[model samples]
Target: GGSPALGTRLKYQRARWERKRSRTAKELLETEYKYLEQLDLVLTYFVTILKAKGTLKPAVLETIFGPLESLYSASHVLSLHLEKGNLGAGLENFCQSLDLYGHYAENLEHFFCSLKGISLFCCTQEQVRKNKSFRRFKKLQETRPQFQGRVLEDLLCLPLQRLHQENSLQLLRVQKLLKGQKTQVLTPGRWYIREGWLLVVPSKGEELKRRMFFLFSDILIAAKPCHPLHPLNSNKLSCQAVYPLQQCSVDKVFGHTWSQGGLLSVSLPTLMQVLFLSWHGVSCTHWSYRLLVTSLSSGKEAPLGL
Candidate 1:
């Protein structure tokens, strides 16, 4: 049997852990309520008004707000579950609805791409300000008690950042792995596009090297797993290179002999360098599409090679 002092210490630690868990659950519930309100603002004030007034075409609106209605519904149900004081049920509800988040994340690049195209073509701030519908909406937003002076941009950005926050646990792990590396920090307005393992093929008959790639709105980062021999760097990733999307062009390699995979050639004409990346299965096509969409959204022209 344990001594009285040991039992007391164990009880104290368990109580502390319980308090921390309780606090975290409460915080999650509170944030969910606020998040639901923001979603409501977008859906009610902006999306509904835009549709009712015929401000944008149906296809354009779909591109700009992919699966937002479904996301709002899922979030509403999750919030209701959380409000019922059952944290376990709330988590279960979220797990059942996880696909909604994945769908939103996958289509996020398209949303920004469509928004950028619109901005470049006809929806500049000056033009929007002069539009009758926008003026009316602006006035309504200003006077609406629920809006609380928040603009459309703020509400629109909420969904984008919500995914980033959802992935905070993975990011925390990444932070620990990159503790000593000089890595570019993720900043607001820079949206994550995609990430995956890829093979780097060399020009000569050299062996293929495996690399991890992270695609963002403006840049692509390639990293390599650190050597296992170094205890401090075990299971860590070391940054290999960062490529600016504006300076790069991607082309699909034709007539590849690989039975189950495809290749992409990322070229930097200014630097006279090309990176041959091989990806397995159908994900190659998906990554190529996302890269093009993200590059265009970042103000770069679509690659002529494509």
Candidate 2:
């Protein structure tokens, strides 16, 4: 609703500002040179502060997939809608309206601030990873609780690195993936070849299920002995096979196997994997997943129905 009005005013003001700035003095070469020097310094300072502005940092969003990125990249209006409103086709419509609103609406400074806090929120998650230091800081027991925002955010991410040394898992690659993403760019299909881990990226067309399907398929194809999602034993109902989930087998129908000229079938193994992963704390969000993936002992199921 706001894009058109904002667009025209922004365009006109920007053009006016540029024109005023570009007008040069015919007689004052020395003053013009100093003006250019000051302009450059001011521009540099703006860049530096914005870089530290939180949401713009790539390290803040590694596990959120590009969904967070896409949300931040939309017209500030649309991103706000996505975060606050329901998830569905309506948000997509707002994102698509970029053609009419122009980039100004999408690139508002408030949009950037929101992303950083969200990024801080994503990277500093305490539940899934459960690092001792992070847990200590997050709790009211010891560390000062008043500090929030990026200060606490980075403090939280500091412990994820320690997971590599303790767990014998290569978490450095994950850190690199988080760090390599540039300002305002959210890469959904980020896969680290060293880790052999492919994050399931969500697209505008696909919701949670499609991304999960791709992640499930990718994990199934890249199995090792006694791994969490190897799909070790399969029973076929039709064209599809049932891979009984390790836990939560009775909790929910994980996946259904399809048949030819017949009825539908379901697999329990996939459900177990999903349930097992969920129980261990892996999630679609960065903060939650970071906690889960960093400290997990691997292949151990949480006490579910037991």
Candidate 3:
């Protein structure tokens, strides 16, 4: 072709911009990788030098920096993905590390924030390319499938939307719980308590193979899980509203005055259910019930109902 059309030129420009952005992000990630390497080396030498001079005990040094060891390993893994241009995987790892910030012995939220800021910058750059619109060309080219796919890939990797520490009440392994309509047979499962919902599934099964039961703060659902042996199109469990929690009654029974082991009974319009939780000490049970009650009460005004 003698010259490309306006749309074609726009597409080329967009692609070029994206490639440039990716390159910049890769450079930033590499810089971070090198910094971390140097930091580790410096830390090792400093510790070694101190120990040799008898200025610092090896145990004291370990006590101080042991937690950082995990952070270093996690960061190294992220850098490896970024260096390989695996942005999708890197982003997922970055998001998951958000949970680890709380676990750091020394506060490292600011460091993680810098990493997030850089990642966001790269994402914004790519987004600008995706949204590069030519107002003159009314019939602009459709969005590239690759860009759409990338968006979807990131979406799936993201944590549960609107889920925060305040909203994520508790996660417990329920030795057994009721499942399905007839309330047939007790089941051992996992219960994930969130601001306004619960995700329940068998504790021992693979994630995809197990069907999820959702109990929103306001409602209860009953449905058959997809058969683990012969799932249809990777069948997903659907929730049906049975009754509103607003009209339901909740009764908690404890083993002792300050009971740790207890049963939380929820009476709905059409059904009654009890969740039993016990730990080595009654304190564990007490906390679980307290958290459950708190989650339920707060869910009434929860910003995200689901």
Candidate 4:
């Protein structure tokens, strides 16, 4: 296409101009350092005004400028290495500089979400391209033809990947937290409750109904059985109990039952010993059930209560 041909011609012209501007990498690096000094003067002027007006809090100012200091230091070191013809050291410093920028990008997004973030964003968008530090980096890279294609592109874009990976890890932690906050172990069972017969029948009526209980890391929940008996039928399970385990201490747990009630009882540790039902006719034995609780609660470690 004509556009591709035009782009190639423009690129060649840009390369020629760049070569005329700086004969070698050292020259380019030196030029960048000089430009940075000019930038520092301008930045210092603005910072002084901001400080005089009391617009910049000490902590906020540190947060904003700490990364910039590191970035500048890295660039200066890289330039020194370049001047000394230390390519190895210069490349090492270059990668470190990129990593520092990645760290800065990660923090910058967080900063932008803060109180004065929007104004900063607008100011930077308006003035950042004109920034000497930015132009310096662009010029240095432009002069180096070896730093073309995927090699340089990926190195420059390392910050975006770092941001994405950090965000993904945060999201993963949130999901794990949400999952841990809820009940994990659920068992479908039955509970026998005595029911009195009608007065006309004149007989004691006893019935057993399907009951289910869920054991969470923090609380225990009693629920009614499902109609269709689907394992994942959440809608069918009606809430019957919600006992917070933190307040209650395990008192007695009975595994064997002789046609009579032999369920686990928990005594709430308070001014008065409040008794709460723990389990009756669970599928697992008392010790096995306790192990399950330990595994779920990670050895009685209470949930964060968040």
Candidate 5:
């Protein structure tokens, strides 16, 4: 009787594990589909339309888009495989096509420079700005309903950001498969929510530092980029600080002092620390608002100053 009961318990645990695996796979596939759609939007609306209208020359267009066509094709192929319920095949296809992503990453800075009229291509910055056809094309993109308020910079960051998210999800899966083996510092219920680059103002009269922040369910982690001089650790992040949401408060800084971008002051009263963060061409207020909401939901009684 004892052996049979133990066997049944083991079977039940296996079934639960299978269910979790299925759910995770489904989530991965759905996210891939959504990402593919976004890529298509960029290709169809920006690339194809610009080419058809002859708004920019081929070289200029290449400078602006830079491997976007290949990225869209790869994403489409992966999405098709995922749609057929073959997550392994889809991931394998993506892995084989990673060189395309690498190429894009290498050229990302050039793409941004061209977009911002920093004169990376054959045309000068003045030529780009004064080009009537390019201005019309940019205006059209701004009016596209599909973009939902996102600019070209936001769209361009999607691939790398998605890569980070995939890594986080894969790590989570590994943790679950190990049955909480304590492999890493990941807590049981904590999960990744969002992550991005932010300029952190450490203090008055101090230089603004670039930092990569990962927002978890209950904490915000600030990490500094490894120095380029150390090639081995160049791609890694060194965690500088972790702010627990339960003891944090976020407030927007008012006035015209920060004219270039929006500012958010994150106060950690318990730790006696304050962090002022800003993002270029992105809504710092929106992120601060979300942080405040997360803090409130974490059972904190602090009121957010708008």
Candidate 6:
């Protein structure tokens, strides 16, 4: 037959067919890979949500994670706002402190070791090196977390502090309002408010519990009604009467609010959430609603279209 050269036609035809098949296969693999990747991420997030379901709110996942799998998602807008907050100096200072600590281990380490009663006489260097528990304890004590100049404290104040002194609201009342959602507490509790003070007592504990009661009562009379108080007074003995708790030991509350001014452990997550709420308002768009009002028009987003 005089149709074509057998070798040349067959080679060209095979090459073209191979190219088409390769292209199709590549596209199919890419699509399948993307679908599989998405499925994997979804599965991981579902697992996290299941583990945390008892703790985290399900509805907030949408606003934070973009309609699905909101695990570990924090708000970008809120982050930007916090970056622009008055915490600039505090953060810078905190960084400086960390740098100093990193650069010099002798002084800080020596002090903490002394605090822990390392007893240089009793322990040989080799023994200290082999002691895993000692090493872990030392590591934890050194890194037990401190914050910038009350970065969180200032954040908690950011929302209400903007109000004039005359109209300034009580922090407890506002906090109560914000946290009014219903939930069961396995540890049962009781709180009573009297004359601008809130008293809380745990169910267990009887003898020293009376001490807690007496302590709070004294604090109330001293606070003069519009003061912020820390949960525990570190010093209960002899503190200069700073406020209500002033009469108590200054050390008892020295590291706490009221008498004040000592390094204290702050809850990082709660601090972050509070900062977000303050910067964004009760919900995320509250700031935008406040900003986008026209002078000529009433500047409110129309009431919920319910």
Specify the highest-TM-score model's number.
5
Q: Is candidate 1 or candidate 6 better by lDDT?
A: 1
Error of 5 at 35 (Å): 1.7
Question: Is candidate 4 or 6 superior in lDDT?
Answer: 4
Local accuracy of candidate 4 as per-residue lDDT tens digits, 135-237: 3543454455443332222332333443243224323322222223343332122111111101111124434333444344455445542323234432233
Please identify model 2 stretches exceeding 4 Å from their true place.
1-75, 79-89, 93-306
| Candidate 6: C-alpha lDDT | 0.26
lDDT of 3 by residue, 79-170 (tens): 78878876545644544454443444122232222433343223133432343341111112113332332322122112222123212322
Per-residue CA lDDT of candidate 6, range 158-230, in tens? Answer: 2212211101222232222221223111111111111211222233553211111111111321121111121
RMSD of 3: 21.5
Instruction: Name the runs in model 1 displaced over 4 angstroms.
Output: 1-176, 257-260, 300-306
Q: Give the poorly placed runs of model 5, Cα more than 4 Å off.
A: 1-16, 113-127, 185-306
On residues 136-164, what C-alpha lDDT tens digit does candidate 5 reach at each position?
77767967888887766667778867766
TM-score of 3: 0.29
Instruction: State the lDDT at 23 in candidate 6.
Output: 47
Query: RMSD in angstroms, all models?
Result: 11.9, 24.5, 21.5, 25.6, 18.9, 31.8
Model 1, CA-based lDDT: 0.62
- Candidate 3 residue 199 C-alpha distance from true site, Å: 26
What is the overall TM-score of model 5 with all chains considered together? Answer: 0.52
- What does candidate 2's lDDT look like per residue over 93-156, in tens digits? 4424323222222222213335345633333444324444433433432233333222433323
Ten contiguous residues minimizing lDDT sum, candidate 1: 297-306
List TM-score per model, in order. Answer: 0.50, 0.15, 0.29, 0.28, 0.52, 0.16
- Name the better of 5 and 6 by TM-score: 5
Candidate that beats the other on lDDT, 3 or 6, i.e. the better one = 3
Please give the range of 10 consecutive residues that has the lowest summed lDDT in model 6: 184-193
